[model samples]
Target: MQSTVNYLWHTDDLLGQGATASVYKARNKKSGELVAVKVFNTASYLRPREVQVREFEVLRKLNHQNIVKLFAVEETGGSRQKVLVMEYCSSGSLLSVLESPENAFGLPEEEFLVVLRCVAHVNALSGPKDSLPPKVSPRHEAVPGQRASSPLSAVAGMNHLRENGIVHRDIKPGNILRLLGEEGQSIYKLTDFGAARELDDDEKFVSVYGTEEYLHPDMYERAVLRKPQQKTFGVTVDLWSIGVTLYHAATGSLPFVPFGGPRRNKEMMYRITTEKPAGAIAGTQKEENGPLEWSYTLPVTCRLSLGLQSQLVPILANILEVEQAKCWGFDQFFAETSDILQRVIVHVFSLSQAVLHHVYIHAHNTIAIFLEAVYEQTRVAPQHQKFLFEGHFWVLEPNLSAQHIAHTTASSPLTLLSTASETPKGLAFKDPAQDIPKFFPKVDLQADYTTAKSVLGAGYQALWLARTLLAGQELMLRGLYWCVETFQATCRRTLEVTRMALLFLSSSLGTERFSSVAGMTEMQELKKVTELRSRLRALAEALSRCSHSITESQTSLSNLRSELLKNRDQVHADRSIQQIQYCLDKMNLIYKQFKKSRMRPGLGYNEEQIHKLDKVNFSRLAKRLLQLFQETCVQKYQTSLVTHGRWMREVHETRNHLRMVGCSVAAYNTEAQGAQESLSKILDQVSHQLLQDRTREAQVSPPLTAPYPSPALTDLVLQMQELCEEMKLLAFDLQDNNRVIEGLSRPPSAPDS
Candidate 1:
């Protein structure tokens, strides 16, 4: 039954009730718009006038979408009592939704995010302006232990309160009201400012206020323990409440409860809240005179995933700290929560590639990243992976989403095909989103990594030292033709010799393919080859240890060489050059004015501070800039020149050593190749004799390596040479590393100004 109040509002429904006031759903008689009227009883007036006035002011001053709108204030005719007319949320409080049996175990993963965003983002539920991470997946495949996505409770309203310099000291599910937004979406709002207060971030509040279940340990001690209210509370007290509220919404129950429960053992509950170590969630037990037994885990009835729990546990444990000092402020809490929300878990179902049946992806992943993941399952390169969309083949890319293909609903698989089988004969794509990818060649990461010209130099390390003799002082770029040409020729010869060494190795060692052709195991040769490999590997390690001092010198020289390389044309490419120029200009400008310009460096730099920088380093003040120029330019360059000249000798010696090894490898290859040929021909003859007569004894004596290389007097010399073929690539990489050393020795000079 409806009741009329002062002929102004008709009380159509009873919304909710607290100790002081009853919220009733009412309709305005004049405009017929619905509003919530908070009718205060005699108990409400028992509070101080200051608290009441502050509450009213907070409601009026706060202007945000997440806050409940204050409509007007009115009084009843018969009782003559105060009533606050506020915006009526049709969807009711989050408390009501949690009360639903379906939500008894907390919201599904999807609903959990909606609640997460409603209250906050990827931060405070704001749009993606540094709020959510770029890859928060809205849709997800049903994986074991992963809760399906669903909407639920939120914290943005509380974030807004903190932003507005107010704290909703009471942040519980009941205080979070919800309204039906467009498309029937729930828009949660933070309400009930009776306990809220305007408090600065650093300022403290003396009074103990807030529901005991969600209160900080300090507040609980005073409120429930009946301790003296001497402990001060900061804005972080509200963070404690948010953690408790979030835990409740996520698991449909309060986190901290003593062995006998809060009501049964109130003092013990206080002990449970305070005594636990930091980052402990859901502290369950500790009765006096009993062994303490507690759990740091959420209840299994909760719907959040293990992945989510891992992410959520740290947040709850940090924010719900008994000690305010350890508690996370709004910023840290918001950032961590925002990061979790920003990750999008896309569900992919491939059509043609059956192995890639279901997969998870971050929405922000580019085509290359997405295909790499696809390749892990299908063995098809990303370039060859084409997803079927809109009657054509479109690859997974930054732009391709569940929305475009219309398989957004769960259980629908994304049709997938591999172009690796060869381009689909009649497959077509329009390429509207510029997703028409180009073919890419197979990549060698190691080769590519060492290929880029080192900033220090780009030639045989020894040639750089030789350049000093051929060209005058290292900075003399014009006379370095002989040095460059010589470096190129040495580099070419080293490669050609290395190839020769490799060819001999392959011919000597019988590979699996070689065994098929030769028709022999060559067991004796294979055994010797293994021993040779072990010996060579040991030798390589010894060489590395001997070159340790040279390696350190190279690193230091390389850093200086990098700095020099940045400005081959020092005035344009060099950053330090520009700084020196700016320092000089400022000094010259101040001198021309006779130091009369009373420009002081601004307290801080902004667009307005440009004017203040002109009068800097005037009169005697200009001397420091000259020192800066000498240190940053001439002095450093000169030091690098001396260092490079010294390191060049070691570089030249190392280059000579490598070339000598290469020449030896070439000689060893000839002996190895002949032995391999003799072994194969002998095996063929033995097989031929056996084929002619099964009972005949066949003699097999392969040709011996007459001029054996390195390991002398070895019948298995051919096998050893062949086995080292694969190891030779490691030698090539070592060669490349040494060649990349700082070799561009040059003389230092002043910046061309």
Candidate 2:
């Protein structure tokens, strides 16, 4: 080993001493280059020659930017140890920089980005693809079955190493070194591969390998701190080391600190392997909401300005997904970073005042919506709306101007936004009625009045529809109030929702998955129950008003019918009994018709089926009335205009009949009435015939005309009676029509139209 060291680096000077080796700062006597030298300790006598040969073989086969470079080994006569020589870096280790603040070792955001890039680049170089010499058993696990490289390179290099039957057992950051190349750039070098091993070798695996802090928890627990090696576990030990390295990089701390003696190592290992990682011990802060909160200072050098901190938290959280399998790997990390950087660059270079102007103009719209919403919540105030519009415009103009500042970045965006919020220029001490001087009085009028009215109408339609369909009347009212306030207050805030939706879509935002079917079921039930309650209240109010109106109309019609009958029965009256009865009937019929028109419909379990049954009954009623009218009155005109008109009028009033075909004049018969005695006999015969013939057809179809004559009732009583009967039939028809309408119409709270 001494001769090999002399061959590698010619000179050596003692620098420090350690348990395993004597370290020195050395220079190549021949080449005048600096290096480090270490001589094997004399006290270690357990197969020293074999260990030295193994170390040389492993180190020589490994080469990486992040790994320390091995030069040579030499042996000298009369010396009890061999010497190992390697390249030396002047800046020392990350450990030294952390321990001493005086090293002037502070990295700004940009510098930090460079560091991360360098680390990523180094990990890419010495990855697991090198074809070198092999040694030991289970080469996939070098240090008792682990890798001897930094955790970052383990997984990437693992499959390649395993394919070639090589394993690194001592994966840790300390063994990783950074070198300066042509441009004074840092490069990584992976060093100290003494514990590497080969697969298919049947030697008993020793547990006394690998750094205690970096060992896999399972391995540590079973190895019992090297007291008695356990014969379990596999190549996943490298994953544990990788986890440890990530932990350190994210939070500048080890998983655990070493303390006590070698026996303490056993306790530490057992704790690591058995206990779960205490998340609270890490530097990531936590709020009551439970999501991890990063400190104000970010570790990476991102292009986002300080003002954009809030915008960046979510991005970071996604990249650092808590789930190990879901976490971003090299490809994902680089891709996402490149995307963000591109956006930043484009924003800086290509952005013009036009963009900011558009944004501010859009903001004006959003503010308008906000104002309308506010008005909806409170009270309608046109003055307030006008004030808000003017104020918003005032605030926006300068903000837009500021956002257009040349070379604007994330840091300046918020600043410009804030500036807009503060000055509000023309709005300060300016009355809305007094149109501000200069800067778009005409444009402002168009945006605030003409455009506002159109936008408000459309926006209100959507908002009200959503509220009425998904919420209740009260909520619908609230939505209206909100729209009005939005239109009035912020003037431009109406566009915020549109912008937010676009941004979220671009961001590829995802929602968390629901955990159970029971949760979904409960949500559905809650919605149904709420809707049911609202419907019940609305139905109750409608029923009450309908009942009262029907009763009042019924009483009024009864009195009027009585008055008509009394007038017809007067002995001194000149009118005939038939004429009087006709007049009274007509009056009664009109009264009944009016009363039926007032009746509203109800809803519930059997409402629909009941409505269908009523339709059939109404057809029967129409037939009976037609029979009575034909027999009682003489038809003058070829068409029964009154009957047809009444039917058409009823059809118009009946919402259910609106879509149905109206009756034609040809469907009604024009026949003269006979004398009273002869008419009675004729009525009986006609009624019988109608029952057997017309009733059947009528039962299956709607009548084309009212079943009463329009002009044959000279006597008020007869007219009133005929009118009453006709009205009764029409009333039934109207009620049935209403029932059908109520049945077909969906509940007010139905989700979709």
Candidate 3:
């Protein structure tokens, strides 16, 4: 190790070490300013000379807040050692935060946003100069029309890089440094351009070098396969690596791991080239043989809201797309991120207003009724009560503009009354008759008042009604305000969570692997699994919609119950009860749809299915069948599987259909033997022998490969007939469940009946 006083800059402490370089905390000997010195051992280390030169060239051109600034470079010991002094980051690398137990759940959503901005900045800096006009120097001021508050600030930084024709090939959590803003906010900077390179006019690069986990699938293919034609890839490759980095920062884990172990680099590379990354979609089952044992749960410590998760998963998906044409560029990514933030803000604000409107409408009616009762009892005119309420108490504004009453107080009761009289119609107050018809059509107020009096005894009832109305009004307003605040907080949290999840999903599952004859079968299966998973997602969404509808109906029912208790109107209560029952019926239909959709069997067993199979012989049989299928079909037809993609699709569809049939059989018959026999029959019909025979014949004769022979088609058609018969039995069971739901949908029997 070099001494602190060995160079022009005095080294204070060791920061970190990598294969080619070691970074140290240092200060300028003259200026005494803190800095980071990345020292490379050119003679002893592997690729240190090349990396150091590359870093020097790239850093010399880039000068942005997000990209690390190069302060100075020094060479010593006859140029055997090279040191590049750069801006010191006190907050350390993002990897430190991700590794911390304190931040085990990953960085908060806001921090993720900072990271995104940083990525966008790097990408912008790498863009073609002519395509984007020159902005203010990034080191001095932010770009015009760019708000520091906007996450899009990062995009400006990336645009700068793009214009300069630089590609930061190695983008990962470990390479991203964090700086603390004056406000204590995180400011991320993209550092370590060791693998970065400048592209030529052809706009393509052949060199495949980056961290293994962050490498794009195409890059992996280029490097591992060593195909000259496929070696050249575009700048979009950087987006994939950034996506991976973002995901790791968000989820505190890499998206793709080697299937077996860390030593399986070839396997990992092959997987990267040939398949979709594992754990990309939220709430889906990961393959058992998948690289990592991923938690189905999102980070509990950094818990993201459902809304954010929904927005982010798709964004990452788009960026990490395997098809370069389908993948998002800097422009699309910047637009999408901006849209996500804007949409979330708008949605939260809109939702808050809608809730406030609901509360205001209810509160306005309650206050009106309370005022009317007071006027009747005290012989006070309605106008006098309205004036007093608007000025002294609460205003009856349907829009909840009553919140501003404190700021817009009147001089006296007389002045308030005059102001109200002059106020525009429907602004401060509306005709009671008109409002009453809108809220409660054809309802007689007189009858309601009479019933209320009878329920609680006349004199005491008016006092109770007044007290209840006043207390409820205050409570409702307070609750409404609280809900708005809560929603605002949730929305903020959701935005962060979504940003993080997008990064995670993108890194884990975003990139598309190349298709090869060897892994074609797995790819086909992946496609089938993806299709089934989508249906499952649809089922889950339907269930979520149903739950939301039920929640709304329940809230309305609770409010109606409160009214019924206070007013004691049998007719109104009955009518409201019927409406709730109708809601229940609608919910049942949704449930039925969910159930039907849920029958689209996943490639692997879900938690529920796994639990159901526990301690059952069927579980063992299913496992055996799965193993046999993998061996017989997957292994033998692995190469030809690509050629027979349609045949493989049929196989998966038949397998799922068989599983469904088995489930039905197990439900009706306690005898495992019966279910086993059904599975055996289905397996035999779609067995490896049939697939093998077809494959062998195809290899022997090319003409037979075009279409299935009459005998084989006849056998497949007969199997389909058997499948239909089994489905008929399951249909009968479905009908039974539907009949039970129908019975529940009927009107409730009266107590007298």
Best by TM-score: 1
Q: What is the lDDT of residue 425 in candidate 3?
A: 16
Off by over 4 Å in 2: 1-19, 43-45, 48-51, 102-166, 179-185, 199-206, 222-235, 257-273, 277-753
Give the whole-model CA lDDT for all candidates, comma-separated.
0.51, 0.35, 0.46
TM-score of each: 0.46, 0.35, 0.43
Better of 1 and 3 by lDDT: 1
Global local distance difference test of model 1: 0.51
- lDDT computed for candidate 2: 0.35
Cα lDDT tens digits, model 2, 30-120, are 7768787766766644555776577677667655445567888765445636777887765555433322211112222333333444333
- Sorted on TM-score, best first, the list reads 1, 3, 2
Give the candidates in order of lDDT, highest first: 1, 3, 2
Q: Residue 257 deviation, candidate 3, in Å?
A: 3.8
Model 1 over residues 1-753: C-alpha lDDT tens digits? 233453254355688888888888887776778888888889988889997667788888776677788876677777777788888899878888775434645666666766666555312321112222333222322234544332232244435555567766777788888888888877777788888777765678888777888888888888888888677887667777777878888987778877667777888788777787765787776554475555577765465644466567877887788775566656667656765665544334332222212333434444455456556545667665545433333334443432232233223334454433321111111111122121123222222122211100111111221221121222222112122233334444444444544443433343453343234344344344455444444433433333343344345435534543443444234354444345445544433332222233323335224323332223122334334434444444444445434433333444454445444443344333344344444444434443433223222433365322233213233443443443454345434433332121111221221
Query: Residue 389 lDDT in model 1?
Result: 34
For candidate 2, give the lDDT of residue 380.
31
